[model samples]
Target: MRLRKPKLVLIDLDGTLVDSVPDLAYCVDEMMKALGRAPWGEETVRGWVGNGVDRLVMRALTNTLWDDPEDDEFEAAHPIFMKLYAENTSGRSCLYAGVVEGIDYLKGEGLKVGCVTNKAAAFTVPLLKAMGIYEKFDIVVSGDTTPKKKPDPMPLLHAANQLGVKAENCLMVGDSMHDVEAARNAGFQVVCVPYGYNHGVDIREAGPDAVIDSLAELKNLLK
Candidate 1:
């Protein structure tokens, strides 16, 4: 598919630009251990992602102890998870293959690059800084930065507005249903990556404008 030179490009963080499951799983394990619960495997934690920390913690608690965590339990676990996660932010995290070159190529093409992620700003900032790509984006919007996250289209639309671009002139690149749905709702083009986590669902089934195995393919498609 040929894409017009985008005035703005909005990228997702987790499971899109970066493979953050390792660090996420580590935090989940640590949180469970703090609660005296058995640890879950990485694959199990992978299935619990994409929703948000509250849902992730609840899912992890349910999987490990066979009981859903109440709001209070999750509240107690939240800070512990954050503390452990902040310490291990980049311990097991790494950018997806070709993500660096892809972003660089887009920037070189004069596209206004931005990040719209469901991750909280606190975690998102440090993670991007650790990955050494924090400066790549002209704007970064986190899940908590807005009243609503992806699937609501507010964040994507908001980012486009912030970049002084129309939604139709922006491209939203991500690896999950939330991304596709948000872009679709916001009247932007959407691209999906096949290798990222999508709650065990095939990303292709999410119905993006295109599905790619690597971000490098995006350069060719856009060109």
Candidate 2:
């Protein structure tokens, strides 16, 4: 079934619009090296993403998704990761297939478009610009843009507020359970893409309103 046409559309960044794992992994491995540990590589780093830089750094330092590094351990490595990531944010990142087409289609339909992600504002804007899609988004709400990020719904709700749209008039397109939960809490319709990082769990298990293989498929569902 087609979803109601929403006044504002919020898309996630990292795993959804762009495959930033290459860049993130590079930084993660380098950070590990800086801390006198071995690199986790791209495939390993891919699963640790979707949270923000802080969590990603902690995961890299601890080498587990669930474990937390001590404050001193985190403090020692977080800055290294941040510096490394700041230098390589988009060097190897690329937009996913159909991203440009999908965003263009939405713009053609006159819908206000936005990007919401747990990534910090420091990295989000630069990556979007580097990927050549910065102009496509009318507003962007990064993890730090609002007081809280995804899985809490503050970012989505903040994006809606910035776009001057009501919760019911917004739709969020993302790739993880955090997206689904956030959209639900924010009272916005949510859709998921299969290819994003979901910590090895199937995104379908998260029960988004629907799942599409590509952003290009979004238009087909939105009528």
Candidate 3:
């Protein structure tokens, strides 16, 4: 079968573009320290990511129990996480292998590229900038940039709108079920990479249009 060329490509950040768990875990550790709590491991932080900073903090604070915190506690913790994350944003962060080349190849093919990540804007921008790939995308929509995040389809739909592409003409590339579900709901095609944070679930179980071992393989699909 002939492959289709997407008019627009929407991508996820954490676990998709960058293996950002190190820095994220550092922030979580810092926040926990500030609150007089024990620090969690990097693996724990990876499972907590792919949602947003608030959810990540909530997960970290609850030690993976995912319990709901009171409004005041959540409010206080949010800024602390943000502050800690901002301070250690790029210290140990790096783009996933093949990500830069894949994005460059997509742009060379004349496709509009956008980022639709659940990471908050404050963290997203600095991380991307530090990776030197912030300018690669035509648009960057963070978790708080829209009313709804992934699995709601609103963020992906909004990204499609910004790229001037119909949802059906776009391809969403991410590492989590949230991206697949969001794309499915928005009527866009999707492909998932195996090496992303999928909440400890198998990425194949998420049921994306295609599963690739590396970002570079994406070019073969477009061939």
Whole-model Cα lDDT per candidate?
Answer: 0.87, 0.91, 0.87
Q: What pairs collide in candidate 3?
A: none
Query: Across residues 61-179, which tens digit of lDDT does each residue of candidate 1 receive?
Result: 66642347777887888889988887887779999999999899899989999999988888899999989999999999999989999989999989998879998899999989989
**Per-residue lDDT over 1-223 for candidate 3, one digit per residue giving the tens place of the 0 to 100 score:** 2247899999999999999999989988888888888999897788887777778888876766468777787787788988778798888988899998889899999999999898879888999999999999999999899988898999999988876899879999999998999999999899999888888889889888898877787789888
- Distance from true position, residue 118, model 3, in Å? 1.4
Compose the digit string of candidate 2's lDDT tens values, residues 1-223.
6888898899999889999999999999988888889998898899899888888988888778878999999999988999998999999999999999999999999999999988888999999999999989999988888887789988888888877899999999999999999999999999999999999999999999889988998799999
Minimum summed lDDT over a 10-residue window in model 3 is located at 61-70
TM-score of 2: 0.98
Query: What lDDT is reached at residue 50 by model 3?
Result: 78
Top candidate, metric lDDT: 2
On the 0 to 100 scale, the lDDT of residue 134 in model 2 is 96
